[model samples]
Target: MVGQLQIEVLGELNVRRDGQLLPLPQSKKTRALLGYLAVVGRPQRREHLCKLFWEVPDDPRASLRWSLYKIRQITNTHDVDRLTADHHSVLLIPQAIDLDFTNVASLRPGDLDTLDVEVLESLAAAFRGEFLEGLRLPRCPTFEAWRLYHRDLVLRSRIEILRRLVSRLWEYPERARFYAHAIESLRGDAASIDLRSEAPDASVSGSSRDVARGNASATANRAGQPGSELADASAEPKAGPTVGTPQARSQAIRFCRASDRVRVAYALCGRGPAIVRAAHWMSHLQYDWESPVWRHWIDALSEEMMLIRYDERGNGLSDWDVADFSFAAMVTDLESVVDAAGLERFTLLGVSQSCAVSVAYAVRHPERLSGLILYGGFVQGWRKRSPHDVATHEAMTTLIREGWGNSNPVFRHLFTTMFIPGASQEQMGWFDELQRITVSPDNACRLHEAFGEMDVSDLLSQVAVPTLVLHARRDAAVPFGSGREFATGIPGARFVDLDSANHILLGNEPAFETFIREVGRFVAETVQR
Candidate 1:
């Protein structure tokens, strides 16, 4: 009970005195300042800290004083000398506190070679989440920038540790598989861990030679193609074979320039007739591949047809600082991705708001599309169809503006519950984190408002391609009745009602099996002709 103070900033900002948890200040800025000091591990000038956390005319120095006073109140109660401040600068006593990130940063490449498996596992588990996960201050751009840089640093470090474990334990396949899954969960399908290597020393440095080889093969494949240079330049690292399943591979992420010069990030997976998914909100190509909420769709659909998906402009790995978040801009993103893939004809799949974009695309270019699949979609958005919901929409927008990017997941949980009411705690947890990291709060509010104004009822009747519409019978996000109306507008569109309350079906649900079977059947029947 007399050791050093412990600070945890890997997942949540937490502190403990003598191994007993201590309560922190209620103010977010106060906790953030403490975290900044702990990670920076040196004295920071008062003016620098003030400008980083507070704006001008706000008495930043006074704000800093109050935060420092709060820090002292918390730490001094336990008689701990954890924080030090001078007239011009402040610092956290690194020797008096144990930090998770600091321990991880101190690890060397050689440590992985000689460390006991148990010790290595403990180190890996220390990185509970992204560095200061879900912590954001809308007014403090400098702090946010620092957080992002450190987040990436911690992420790379975690990846290296997992890679080393997989390599060092290559003799133990089950043990290696365990670490491989950990890497997969973190990096999604973007992870490049190979368990087949006989020599562990070859990977001691934690390099990804397998990924290099895959990129080489991809480069050779595109060698003679006209736009191959552009494709190669845009191609991200190709994911290697996963630990247990050799066939489960992720497509290399590539960028395509939209007509407006915005770069759109997209990925193509599996091998067969192409199936293009319209860009949708709350999607990250890298993260979604391993997400419990979206991985089922990727796995099932990619089994039969080559599945292509992309982040729409202003979301995910795409250009987030975009000026356009309109329906027109989203449709253009779809167009650019398809043209870049050089597909002659493909089936189109859309979910949620992107359903309207898919409808518009199918209507404008019927010959380029073989079929359409819409799930939990509506022709008219909430504002366009339901005047009574206007007040609710505005309130939701206000909540997003205020609470979207905070560490607490309550704001995001509101959307998650409506989308997947049947989700397990694990699924719900991932969805909550997904929304926060997918895009900025400003973009979230902007996208929300933009989707509300979408009115694609006219485009529905113009859709000439073969279509299948599947909707949960009791969807909370998009009503089941809207799904019926959407299907009825399109000529010869098959409508199926899934018996579920969740807007998006979970993988374990019976409705999901039915949804997947119906989709495969419809695609097979339509594509043969």
Candidate 2:
């Protein structure tokens, strides 16, 4: 490619070609228009562009054409198609432009922990100031909103990158303190990124006003506290689809349709060898990101690997209106998520009911997986186990059907107690609310029934990949014998007994540390082999 175009909007609006600074259109509106197209990363309609820039008193179309002419002077070269417009729409080819904003645009919340130390330092140095510094268009409200919203996104990411840098550079205290003390004043203004602030969503077909608003009202409804693939949109076509949510800025929780046509939600984060955790239990991708129970789990796991997690078909952020609750369907959910994520080779992680799902997948697609990790899982469902277990499941079924959906925490507490008996009041309360909110009462019972009938014992021996089985010694939900069963049944499976009663593993206890330490070591070994 000849005549490379580079655009930097992280701090200032600087456009360059092949290391030579280029002059831009004198009009602030024209420069603002260029900034918008460069950051949006997609095609925009001509009429909408006219509305975003030119008002009715002016010849909007003629003015837009003039701006496009000026923009092309600086952008398109080397047959790169960097600036392209047809009769209907105009688009900037993001691939052709070395936009500096993308450097931080790609940084998500959990990403800093996984990034190399050098990479972290490099990213730290990239942030010069708020995005598009001093390029304020007070007259164009839509453009102003976009600029301000993105400024917040960029500033928040900058703060997080600095925070991670401080933590990582502790041995180099002088440098760490330099970043710490230098930016000590900046955090008060922008550190807390209010992701609740909505951005415009240019619809497939909408008027210029619609384009200008980007549907802020709609955006407010779609955007949750942080960027949740669950709340904003469910499905994505590929992995590493960048978003601006706090679960490391871009750990996009997206969706894909299963063969059965169920829309399954999944989140992929961090930067390393992949580890796909088959969805199990009550996991809301949005809520769990900030929750005490699952947040640490996600943070620790994503630290060393590109962790992929999903909501089940009938639970969490996945399509909850599903009909298929069969054992085969459960396995298929994991398959669909992994495929949607575009993972070539990953160590599969299975917890609780998903253990059976992971085992079955391993047997079917041994070449696609490096290893398997099973925690607090069972070889046989209650129905497939002893009569006492079946009886207990039958009793639990009655309780869930009646009170699982009730406002009272009594019924939910029963399930929560079993999973994390050693949990503090706060943790138990979070789990209680999660159980009630994640799934409907009918589906809760259905999930329980489906898990109870999972006869994966026959498939356990078929597991071809290396495996690790961990179970809390005093786990009240699933017996200690259950984890032992997986260890014995799967060939070359290593087992460890975590000394805790909690099935989810609270952060306060030593078991959580052991869990992380073991998983990290196992993953490292898997990467080497």
Candidate 3:
């Protein structure tokens, strides 16, 4: 206790130094900045800090410097530098502090169940109340948004622990019932207070298929719903969805709750006409940010326009232990991400399986779209391609399940080659590693099984958006005819044929360059200025 400083942020802003509570700075912004730096516990750029806490026409840099000085009241000591700020970035390195909430916040989605009971209970106890309680600055919208999101995160962690305790403490019937009641109470509050608008419905929705028939109209109604009211920008950022400020170049990965309450992770980059890339099988937002195979695609797209992308429900950075991996639910996920990203009207980009989903979305919510782009997509999935294709699809599913998570790269190589036969050794290795880390083998097999059954041929003719279709000539994963079918089937679609065998175009190849140019030109033409 003599050498340690205990800072509690799960509830209000409370810092104790050597068994004596310290008074916080008078300025709410300073106190807010202190909490933000402590929670992130990472070196944040001076530019980012300026944008996050202060605004223009008021000398934001000077205000930031003032705030740093105020924060030093608690952090400054003769010991090591707890609060480090320089020309480039600001960092808070607590010499001795409690990081239980930060540790829980950093956890991967659905990993709470994997943790030990004692640990969950310990983390659960940290939540005395809301995060940074009473710390809300309406003028500083970005900081307010961050605070609200972190609060929802605490809400989620609390509920998950209660639910886990209810299920695990079977022998302790009274204790189990207490936890069960706690979950209901939390859900009840979430429903009334709207901690997350999706929590109540997701509790009863179970699987996406079970509710698709009942919620189809509901999905349509919610698809075009607008984002929350933030003081700045068109859309406000949240725990589930974070949109970038116009001048903020860095990608801030955030979460958006799908209709089923599944936390779908999304990020926004660049500034301009928005482009929403619907989640596909191998999408990992954070992982693909610097990936060799996908980085070029992200970089090219972001430079041209604001690129909005998310990991689909069951894979990537999204919650893995999802109840539904159905085609209908994927449509819901797309709508959720779009609303969270806060675009009034924007181009939608669909690749592979998402192409079908985009078709369905275009048909359902044509008013929300400026244009639709389908790349390497099919009118019918592998199995539904024809009656004779069923056997082959099933066989591939079985093969992938058996060898998916194995150390041997043979299975991965076989699959990766089909998608990117033209890939270099480095690209191929990236693809292989992507499969192992982003998705579990069981979920992969389930998605494979579901994708094969997808039949959106009925929706293709119904698409009303300005449409563009691009496909490789000899893609081993999907047939060249599949691409031709989309162009022919859609009412008014333009098709571009790239002279490559790979389903996924490699960055070094000419086809990728053509792909970028065409997309940029089409988006520029279609997006409303």
Candidate 4:
């Protein structure tokens, strides 16, 4: 007896029947054609498929015929009628096969709020990944256009479901945050979708919360099963179970006094080898885990290592009203946090001005560090780079002092754009709030001034730890040459140039993927030694 036919087009394209996987055609164009037909869910003209997938081929019609024959050969083994073709058109018989994409496409906005919790959970699980991930036909412009449009449509639908789930599970903050994380992972910022706007009278029943919790538990159980595609599902959501998983929960905030007697707030999360992030100019130990701009980093890094992040002496949950905001104090803060965290040796991660602080620490305590990873770092600060930078710094500091906490995001927008030019509107909004709440206007100016005057050029050559330097090619905050200069100063340091404009990597950018992959590899190699 033939079993049910199921087509999965979420993560990787696959066709299964009777609990058996079917081999697809070797040609990507053939696979693309099959996926498009299944997703389009209607009869397509034979000529249209030919033009879409083989537009650049010399013999488009002949190519299509060969592809169809190969597809038929594969499908005929399972069920010949799975794919139906006439002389002029072709279609995947809807009754013969079940398609995840079609099921997802059938969902409406109202279903998100009104549907049973179990039903909503099933719909959420259906979205394993972006539509047709890693399936690209270089020369097929028509196919590519259609794929993008369909992908966007699926993304919108997924976002709507997630938004409504979050609203409906309002009392269950853990589940709400889980969906929020999924929404952000899909590059659909949850903040952009106002839950209130979606369902004004949305209310969750006790049974609904139980259903959602059960769904989360089921997801966690599936996360451990062998051969599961959990990693590829949605940017490593399987790294942990729910948003309230141990790593996602609030870390215990501890205070350590610096040499200058200023209190520095720090927290350690996850479990593995210690990896310390240098306290940059802006940080909030409490809000950072939930913020859109930083949560991705927190989640991804904590999955493999015990990530230690902290607020500098004058920002976030640290002592904001401080007497000192100098480079010496910054280094002291790092030293105190390291000691407080009780790390004999750990990997050091630094970005922006904190790169200098990290470099200085590595130099002062070479035996204390196992590896160094710096992004968009510079040995010399803006004022010391050139006279031009001095004037620019002065102007920026002036603006921060004058319009730092204004209700209007105009002044803050300038900083946000330069830092993350590719940030979504939701990200921009979160960053603006972070800036205002992280530190006062006076502290902002002081921080920028301190960054401008920072000069660790002489300390670069003294670094003794294995180092990896990364910089965005078009980083607006730090010049690409400056990053190169930093690498050049350190003997045998490796340098990677990221193709991005954002100084701070955004979650959705291609550069972030490269960054994470490389960093993971580097950390693994370093620990092996």
Candidate 5:
């Protein structure tokens, strides 16, 4: 314990002697200074450190010297000079010093159990309050950016770890402690559906390759990965535990055009008027098949009705060899799935981007729709890319193209901010892993391209079905304006704006539950199903 010094400073700042916790002196500035320097985990300019800790100083340099002195007096370390100095550069010694920042930074996907106890202790300690609370540094943009960057990284990493644990324990109701803690970390409403009982036979397929490797012929039939070999192998039984009875067989209905093997995917549950629900990007029907989040929502709609959920063409169990993804292609896919499912008329629930598709479907075939529900929807097509936005998108695509594997952090942040706003580090990590496994940059780009050109405003007026448009006031991705626009376009479309910002119904339980309840009642009263 004495030979190797482990200093954990990320969320909360704590110094330990060996494996045992050591009391750090109680001073706000000192702790802030130490945490800031430690977060750099590298050398920093003395000027930067001083500007970060001290706000208004008559002599800022001298103020830095005084703060350094106080920090040294409390920590009893010569490294104070290394973390701060006037002339020379400041450095935090990497070797022989153990800290949670190091551990959390070192974490990768698929290695949760191997995380050392010291790292956990350090994370628990550093995460006390908001970063550098009660203090605002002078106009140093570099310091401000660095402070935010480090804080976000730590928060994101911690959340990623917890999210993985939450996913793994999802089916184990016995691990309620882990689930409860995970939910608390997520800031998600505790009233969300439970994964265990609702999705008893559901399984989570880790990745597309995992999904592909198990069934090469099937993957080849779906065009396989991004590029595939056409050599046909004999069809083997599908992967996973097989249900002996044909009634229990969960088969995907394929929607394909003549001379085109690429198919749209749909899953059917229950019997009666078909209800179609659109999931966001990065869906795995095999995995979601088991997710209580999906099951509960679907089950609610499926009662006295036939419910259909489909995987968009480029991902999930759907055929992936399409040259491009467009609203037209997506619409065709939807039509195909409906055709295969043999649904003549149905209700539609469009979530997130899929809301556009739902609108398109209703507009195109108003005669076939009994009712339409739009949740967290947007109306703008990404085709109107300003120069800046186009540049941003290109840069994003480049970054994603550069790396999209389990270790990629860019996709992690992108996925987190898009879907799980304020998600924990663990959750982000798990999603990053899952996202990588589901679709590739090529496929994602195709989908993005489709979203870009998607203009459903014209179709709104043509919608013949009784439509309900629901959105969250605080949705960060698509502003509430999009929802308003969607409702305004569709004749007599009812618009409901909720108080929450969770884009997906899975995260917003009470609101979603109420939404489904209302929709059920609406369908009962409005539709002749």
Candidate 6:
């Protein structure tokens, strides 16, 4: 049996036996040594430990040994054992102690509301101050760097988890206010470190008390880095499980055979004709909801169908292998999501570049599909060789590769203009963050490469299902001509060209209403067949 122990280090460090507080060793250095190792929990050599605490005299080797002896004596734990050394190499075995940090790492997204609420509460209460109190050593640059690295990682993880919890606010409305406050508090003044001038003003203010208690839920959400509520709410949860698994609310999963495969990650709501949504490059099943773009999309779709969307294999919650963004691989990923959702026949809705996949699915599986809908999409590449296009693609790819967060303002403006058009200040921030969450530069380049090669003209002619193609007249990324061509190629395909521009429709009433009217007509008319 694995023995159990409790160690809390929020404001002050406290160690407990089974349920009672235990007396710690006298030496300050010794307590600090044990506390640091327990929190880090990774195997380390003796030389490394000595370097971390430079206060330990010049002879780090002897000082390391002395610290080890003291740690064992104070804790009465046999888990700390010395490894065989080569030259200055050293290692410590921390297999015995059950640290709270490890427990925090184990929380998953699918846990019941009760358990998830408790875990979040406990973790929020743990990270009280810096890792160690006041053990300063001018010579321990390595320690300082390591400490900062771990501290940031912990903070990032907490933010991500809390974000997921908030996204599933539908599941536990009661826990929302508490988690929101905790998330905002933990974030401190991170928003003050602005990376762009024109940032969003989204905030998170909905709690059970707010909803049930009649308080106002905040209006817009922004990207997290620049003090946006959308950013805080949409941050991706750190690693674990795929789609409804305990650790993750949504996961990108792959199910393949030979050359055919499908990658899909989904957030499910209701059950009926499943709306298989093909998303533009970046998406987190959970994070996207924080953005108004996704909110409007889901609100419209879920009224009639269960929405199934996933990041393309190289984007969002999927694997990060850049070379796997080929069309063939993407089709396979979609198949996996369909199979996972266990839907036999359903509607397929393609958005932005994903229209390519929806068209392919219709041509290949017309018999298995209930209907098809395309919105703000294109059949051909935007412009063959405009220098502006090339520069935009290259610049965005470079920014993603260099680092996607708080770094590139040009890329943000370009994408915001393309996706959300005249979005509110908060709305633009949400779009910027959603794009960032989509994929890295390497992956984005691969997606762009795949998109460049897609020519679905031959396949469009083969689609026989009831199809509705909706395109914005002023779509910056995809021209109206492509939507027209798509409708022309498919026999009996109905086309509706809206006066609005922005690719994803951005909550425009007239455009959205037009889309719903056309799509609803198609779905209702076709289902009778």
Which candidate's lDDT is highest? 1
Q: Candidate 5, residues 155-232: lDDT per residue as tens digits?
A: 445544444443444455344234335435433211111111101111323332222122222333333221122212
Off by over 4 Å in 3: 1-121, 124-249
Q: Which stretches of candidate 1 lie over 4 Å from their true place?
A: 1-229, 232-238, 242-247
lDDT of 2 by residue, 354-424 (tens): 88888999999999988899998888889988889889889999999998875455778888888988877
lDDT of 4 by residue, 217-263 (tens): 22212332221211111111122221222444434444455766575
Per-residue lDDT over 116-181 for candidate 1, one digit per residue giving the tens place of the 0 to 100 score: 877888888888787876577756654664565456447655766776777667677666766766
Q: Model 2 — TM-score against the truth?
A: 0.56
Question: Where does candidate 6 stray beyond 4 Å?
Answer: 1-263, 382-406
- For model 6, residues 1-529, the per-residue Cα lDDT tens digits are 3234566543345677666777776656666666676775545545446645744547877777776766555455555333223344433334655565665545433342345545655665666654444543324433443343334335544554555455455456556666656555653422211111111222334443332211123322322221121111121222233211233132222211112222234445534466778766877554554346766776677667566666566655444543466776666666655654456678898887788888887887788788888876667653344678667766756665565443344566576777668677556755665665556666766677677667677788789898888898888777788788888988888889987877767676588888877876787777667
- Which of 2 and 3 is the better model by TM-score? 3
> By TM-score, how accurate is candidate 6?
0.53
For each candidate in the order shown, give its overall lDDT on alpha carbons.
0.75, 0.74, 0.72, 0.72, 0.56, 0.57
Give the distance in Å from residue 237's predicted Cα in candidate 4 to where it truly belongs: 21
Q: What clash pairs does model 3 have?
A: 239-255, 240-255, 240-256, 241-255
Superposed by TM-score, candidate 4 places the C-alpha of residue 60 at a distance from the truth, in angstroms, of 53
TM-score per prediction, in order, is 0.61, 0.56, 0.60, 0.55, 0.51, 0.53
The TM-score between candidate 5 and the true structure equals 0.51
